[model samples]
Target: AQSVTQPDIHITVSEGASLELRCNYSYGATPYLFWYVQSPGQGLQLLLKYFSGDTLVQSIKGFEAEFKRSQSSFNLRKPSVHWSDAAEYFCAVGGDGNNRLAFGKGNQVVVIP
Candidate 1:
């Protein structure tokens, strides 16, 4: 069985502050991991992914994450989050194919100015 769980359902942070979102997964083998962001009433955008190489992976919008095999976790982090960074974040895992993706419910991020 393969599945993903994000403990936090929502998070609020002040602009220009560090941010970290947690993600946990349950899978039999090494799995393809991904982090996606979606703004209110918008589609998902890929933040980053961990397939096989180095544990740390960087994304487009100044975001990065580390894949911890032992913890069965792939948590996302940003040094200084921007107001534009406020959005819903989802952690996903896929293997068999790209056809389907199992997504965590999502963690809504609110940025206070």
Candidate 2:
């Protein structure tokens, strides 16, 4: 069985401030972790992913994630956030040998200018 958990339900940050969203996952085999962002009333957009090699992967809109197998955690970080970055972010783990993914409840971010 596999599951993802995002400890933060909501986060608020001022424009140009740093942001970090926590994510933890449980998987039996090699885990494929991903971060997806969804704007208000919009579909989810792929942020980044970590499958193999290098611990870090970069995605669209200045987002990056690091995967730690030992800690079973894949946290998302942005050096600086813009007001338009406000969205609901989800952390997901891919099924072993399958394309299916199990996503967390999501962390909602609010940006203030």
Candidate 3:
């Protein structure tokens, strides 16, 4: 079984500042990693994902994530976060043989001026 852990439970970042969120996973084989963001009254949105090939993947809204197999980590980063970016972020791991994904506790991001 695969599992994901997001170390930060809550994060506060200033508007226009860079933001990074840590994610670690434990799986026997190559895992499918995903970063999802959810805003108040909105459904979960796919930010980025990793399956194979490139170690780094880019997504919508200027979000990117790098997959580091050696460290069992897939961290998400944004160069300059906007107020709209303030939301709940979740890291999930699955794939290979697993059909279902396991998500982390989630990180609540609050953007301030």
Candidate 4:
């Protein structure tokens, strides 16, 4: 069984500050990891993914994430966040040959000016 845990349910950030959303996973073996963003009324958008090869991958909207197998963590980071970045962020884990993804509850981001 694979699961995702996002410790922070809500986050507040300044308009130009950097951000990091933590994500942890539990799985029997190596699993696929992904980050998705959803706006107020929009569908989920893929931010980035980690399938194999290098642990670090670049994502859309100046976002990036690193996969740490030893720590069982895949954290999302943004060098500088904008007001437009305010939304619900999700972390999901799939693979395992089941074609299923187990997602975290999500992190609600609020950008303050």
Question: Which is the leading candidate under lDDT?
Answer: 4
lDDT computed for candidate 2: 0.92
Least accurate 10 contiguous residues by lDDT in model 1: 94-103
Q: TM-scores of the models, in the given order?
A: 0.94, 0.95, 0.97, 0.97
| True-vs-predicted CA distance for residue 67, candidate 4, Å | 0.2
TM-score of 1: 0.94
lDDT at 5, model 4: 99
RMSD in Å for model 4: 0.7
lDDT for every model? Answer: 0.91, 0.92, 0.93, 0.95
Clashes of each: 0, 0, 0, 0
* Candidate 3 similarity to native, TM-score: 0.97
lDDT of 3 by residue, 27-68 (tens): 998899999999999999888988889999998699999999
Q: Over the stretch 8-71, how does candidate 4's per-residue lDDT look in tens digits?
A: 9999999999999999999888789999999999999999999999999997589999999999
Candidate 2 vs candidate 4, lDDT winner: 4
lDDT of 1 by residue, 22-113 (tens): 99998777789999999988899888999999999998789999999999999999999999998999999987544567888889999999
Candidate 4: lDDT of 48? 95
| Candidate closer to the true structure by lDDT (higher is better), 1 or 4 | 4
Q: lDDT of candidate 4 vs native?
A: 0.95
- Residue 44 miss distance in model 1 (angstroms): 0.9
Tell me which residue pairs clash in candidate 4. none
The worst-scoring run of ten residues by lDDT in candidate 4 lies at 93-102
